[model samples]
Target: MSITVYPARRILTMNPSQPEATHIAVDGDRVLAVGEVDTMPRGDGCVWDERFADKVIMPGFVEGHSHALEGAMWDYLYLGYFPRHDADGKQWSGLKSVEQVQERLREHAACLPAGEPLIAWGFDPVYFEGTRLTRRELDEAVCDRPLVVMHASFHVMTVNTPMLERAGILDGPRVEGIMCDEQGIPSGELQEMAAMFVVFDALGHNLFEKVSSPHVLRRYGAIAAAAGVTTITDLYNPMSDEAIDAMVEVTRSVDYPVRLVPAMGVLQWSAEEGIARLQAALPRSHERLHFGLAKLMTDGSIQGYTARLKWPGYHDGHANGLWNAAPEVLTELVQAYHQAGLQLHIHTNGDEAVELMLDAIDQALTLWPRADHRHTLQHCQVIDHAQLRRAARLGVCLNMFANHLYYWGDIHYQRTLGPSRCQRLEPLASARRLSIPVAIHSDAPVTPLGPLFTAWCAVNRRTASGRQLGEHEAVSVGEALEMITLGAAWTLGLDDKIGSLDVGKYADMAVLDQDPLQVAPAELRDIKVHATVLGGRVHGGD
Candidate 1:
């Protein structure tokens, strides 16, 4: 294999004592050496690439848990919660009231030719507390124009009158989640997967057939490369065989700019059915696409006040939240999959839901005794210290929604779980103390898929209200970076092959404008991707 040396001011291999190096030697798609310029051995007399003279090279950022296709789908549809500064610019996600939403809607609607669905995402009702915009509010915002405002939760959305009428949901069966008036008329709020499926079904065929076309998938890949992400665990792909084929074609077409680890979105499936579905997909493993695990959204989100919390949820005196699936249903699913030699990635945002998962995992272990399975529990948001200890014992990996601290920390502290349970949120420190392998995730579309910001959130734990929730739970900047790289790779069972820039590891790396460890915590989010190299090929940035 011909070799090329990449010389940088600093290289963060994330290899503990020797975290920083001066150069990295690449032979084919693997790193041959990472050390000082003089000590590096040349691959057959190949010279240095000399392209990264002044930049900081780090192991490419990996988003352990995210909805890649869904995030792309959101980009394909409505403007993000963040402002769309222009026709195409960095979007703004913070809007204060219904008036602002209407203004943005008018701007987007005016740009369209006519009759196009005015879809907008990332509008969280909790953000505009005391003034929750109902379906009636959305109707007035875009009169005669079809509109659908997806909640930041992505687990729910509030559709306008036109959208409701189009889907025939206005007078449909009284689904417990769809917002309704005292008269039992549809109110616009569509909560959980059941209600959202109504809108998704109405949209016609799956997005795989349209938005994620070859042309669009290329653009999405470009976006990932530009963002400095080399690996992402897609949390909510439709899991259809067609979707997998599209992704595989995209990856093989020109070497995917980022490696995709797709988790089959498993809902309403028995363990047997889930395994059968994986077999049906018949995905062939490649350097870029790995479809081995299953994603289970077992509970609703906390922001919508639908998470299955313990007794006293929502500081505002709301009772226990709701569950997406019953305990019996989840237990059977976990057991069947565990017995089938498949990995289970369950999404549990509430403490009660976390408890149920722990119980279910314990039962599965009893029936199918096999160690090192490394089944993961995602979105462990409202879990307790005790839960962390339990997770450590069971070898259940955790992919924490660390971005929750920045996006919903204040709401959770003041409204959702109150001050008492707030300190235990994320609990990375407790997880570290217990020797648990914890990974961080954006759960994008829930939070944008920005690994640096997620790392910052894990390290700082700063709330939207500018208050620190629990300083003790904060992780170091190094630890935060690893949570998305090495730790995340371990969770995906790709550590030996992908994580750090070590000898024999794949030459998957990113060049950032600045070293995250050298910058202020707040500035971490501001750093931009200078370049990204995957499998020794430069695909994005300068």
Candidate 2:
């Protein structure tokens, strides 16, 4: 096999054995060695490439809690508070007010074929001055065509009257998640998956089903590649047979860009059924499509006022949030998946819910006694150091919602949890101090998928409002970098294969214009991802 040596100004391998190198030699798709140019082995058919000589290469970022859905959703309009850039590099300006949001929707709707549904995502009215967005305001945009607007939290959706009538859900029963107005009529807001599914399916769009197509998955990989991400978890893909097959096919394709680790949603099946399905698919997992995992949403979003917090609940005095799955149901499901040997990723946002899931994992351990389950607690946002300690003892790693500190920190401090609890959110430093394995993620589409920005958020703990929420809990820049790279890989159980640019590992690296460690802490997010190399192939090159 021909060996190619790619030289760079500096290579920051997360590996401890040889942390820094000037060149990486790859044999086929695997790294043969990482060393200085002069030190590399000289042999016939060896190729020395100096194209990235001035670039700084590091292990590509791993995002443990983001979704592939971000790829396909760009087809819809984005009305987020933060400015975003699409895969094609087109910039979408932020919509700060409800008026801008309405105008943006109206403009997108007009451009579309007349009378088609104006579907949009990333619409969070959490910071808006008035009440939650209503159907009335949306009607002013376009009364003729139907509209489906998904909330940023991904827990709720606001629909216009045309869409509601088209779906014939105007007379639907008064349910827990179906938000109602003063007269007990269905408001435009639909909360949670169960409630949102009514309109999501009605629109004739199944994002998870669309994921079964190779075209969609390839586009998703392109988006991930642009973000400097090499390995990412779909986190909660429905994992249908067709979808899994598509993922395997895409990963096997020569053009595939990122490694996909999909955790099938447990809510899609009974405990027994989920275990059986996972067991059957264990042998079919592809090199790029890693499987044998399950996802359980233990509680809802904290900002949407739907996360289950402990006592002295909401600062606004709203009722405590909803339970995504009953305490008993989550516990029983955890035990079954644990005994079945499938890694479980539990979505726990509130502290109360974190405690519940921790207890459930402990219960599962009692039955199975596996030393290294590594079943993660995704978005354990409001967890305390004590619960984190408990989680550490129980061998549960945390993929904390670090991006929350920037996007929703101020709102959480002022509107939801009050100052004390908000200041304690994420607890990155405390987790590091206690020797707990922790990683941070952007949970893209909810926020943007930039690991550098996520790292900056952890290091600075600054909010959009420009206040430092958790001054005492800020981690150092180097520590923050690890959280996005090796730390994230550990959470995904792919550390040995891709976290470091070590010998025998896949040659995956992110090319940067500058080294993040040498830059200012606040400027970390400003560092550009020039390109990324996956298994020795360059993508998104300048």
Candidate 3:
């Protein structure tokens, strides 16, 4: 194959041997050399491609934690606090009040066919002060059909009275996740997966099944490409044969711009079944679609008041949070997966949950001695210094929800965790100081999918209200950039193949209009993504 020498204004190769370069030579899908044009090997068919001569090139971003639902979510009504753009590049305005939310629901309800269920997502009650969305309010929008609104956290959801009645929640046995009104009636609010599963069954809309469709997969690739990401994780997926087939079919197409790394959602099945399923699916792994990672959900979301915290719980004296998996169950799953030699990506949002996971990992490691396990804690928003030390000692990675500082920092500081606890929400700097492998994520559809924006949140710990939640926990721009790129790659166990622009690695890079390292910390998110080169094939550019 002919060698293509792509010259650029500058290349920020994360490789330490030659950190900066002016040109990179690509042979097929792999990088042949990264240096000045003269120093690179030349052949008879070598061609100099100066398409990005004025652009800065860096390793394409690796989104360590995100979901394919980000694409499927655009199909539903968006009721988030912040305005967002969909996969098709259409911008949707944010709803400011409960009244506005109801109004939008009413509008959407009128357009739908009679008796058809209405499902909306990204509804956050925190943004609305002194008010909450109740079933009665949702009934006023569409009393005849089922209406369910998913919270921004995706941890809790509210349903209309008709839907609650349809799901038999009102007459069902008392469940921990089902909230009750003052009169001991089902309040229409479902807290965690258990309660939500009942509603999902009644609605007959299995979201995981829908996410595997080719259309959703294509949209996910488009969204990732638009953000200059070359590799993204569908973090938690039900690895059904049909889902796997859809992923393979969609990703095998050359037009699909991003590579996918899907981790099996192990909680849906028994530990033995999950291990068996993962083992069976390993043989089907493709270049664009990777398998062999597993996910476990221990607790819920902090913003939704469903995450299990340590000692003094919620600031306003609300009840303690709930766990998706009981402590014993989580420990059993951890031990089984560890013994099976699978890298686990466990979700633990609260301090208590973090502690539980650390203990479980420790026990699992003690039972089965494995090296470089790289078991990671995702959305570890409320972990403290002591937990960081334990995580480092256990060889565990921490993928902090850095985007939380921007989206829900004020709420965390003022209501959920109070001032002192909220100050160290993500604590990226502390994790780095302990020499723990660390990464930051957007957790899309919860926040939004943009690593540059996520990096900026880590660099400047500033919330939507312009408050610096934790100045001490903030990391430098260089550190933040590394967290999004190489650090994230490390968490996913793909550091050797794609994190940096090094020789012998895949030629996957993000072409930028401005240098991220040269810009002001505040300007990092504003930097334009000119194009993304995946395996040497450019996707989008001017």
Give the candidate number with the greatest TM-score: 3
Q: In terms of lDDT, which candidate is strongest? A: 3
Candidates ranked by TM-score, best first?
Answer: 3, 2, 1
Mind giving the per-residue lDDT tens digits that candidate 2 earns over 441-474?
A: 9987688888889999999999997999888889
Worst 10 residues of 3 by lDDT: 203-212
In terms of TM-score, which candidate is stronger, 2 or 3? 3
Q: What are the runs in model 2 whose C-alpha is more than 4 Å off?
A: none
> In candidate 1, which residue ranges exceed 4 Å CA deviation?
70-88, 110-115, 205-212, 268-270, 280-283
- Estimate TM-scores for all models: 0.94, 0.97, 0.98
Mind giving the per-residue lDDT tens digits that candidate 3 earns over 97-144? 888898989899899999888999999998787777889889887798
lDDT of 2: 0.85
Judged by lDDT relative to the true structure, which candidate is superior, 1 or 3? 3
Per candidate, the number of residue pairs that clash is 5, 0, 0
The residue-by-residue lDDT of candidate 1 on 1-542, one tens digit each, is 67889899899998775788999988888898899989687545787777788889999878788765443554534434444332245556556778877887877778877777877777778877787677888877787777887777877788889989888887665555787789878888888877777777787734323434555556556666767888877666666656777778887865668888878777745566768978665457788878788877778888878788876656788656666667788877888888888888898998889999999999889888878888998888878877888999999999899988888888888888888778878999889888898899888656666788888888889987688888889999889889988999989888888879998988989898798889998888788889899989887655
Error of 3 at 250 (Å): 1.3
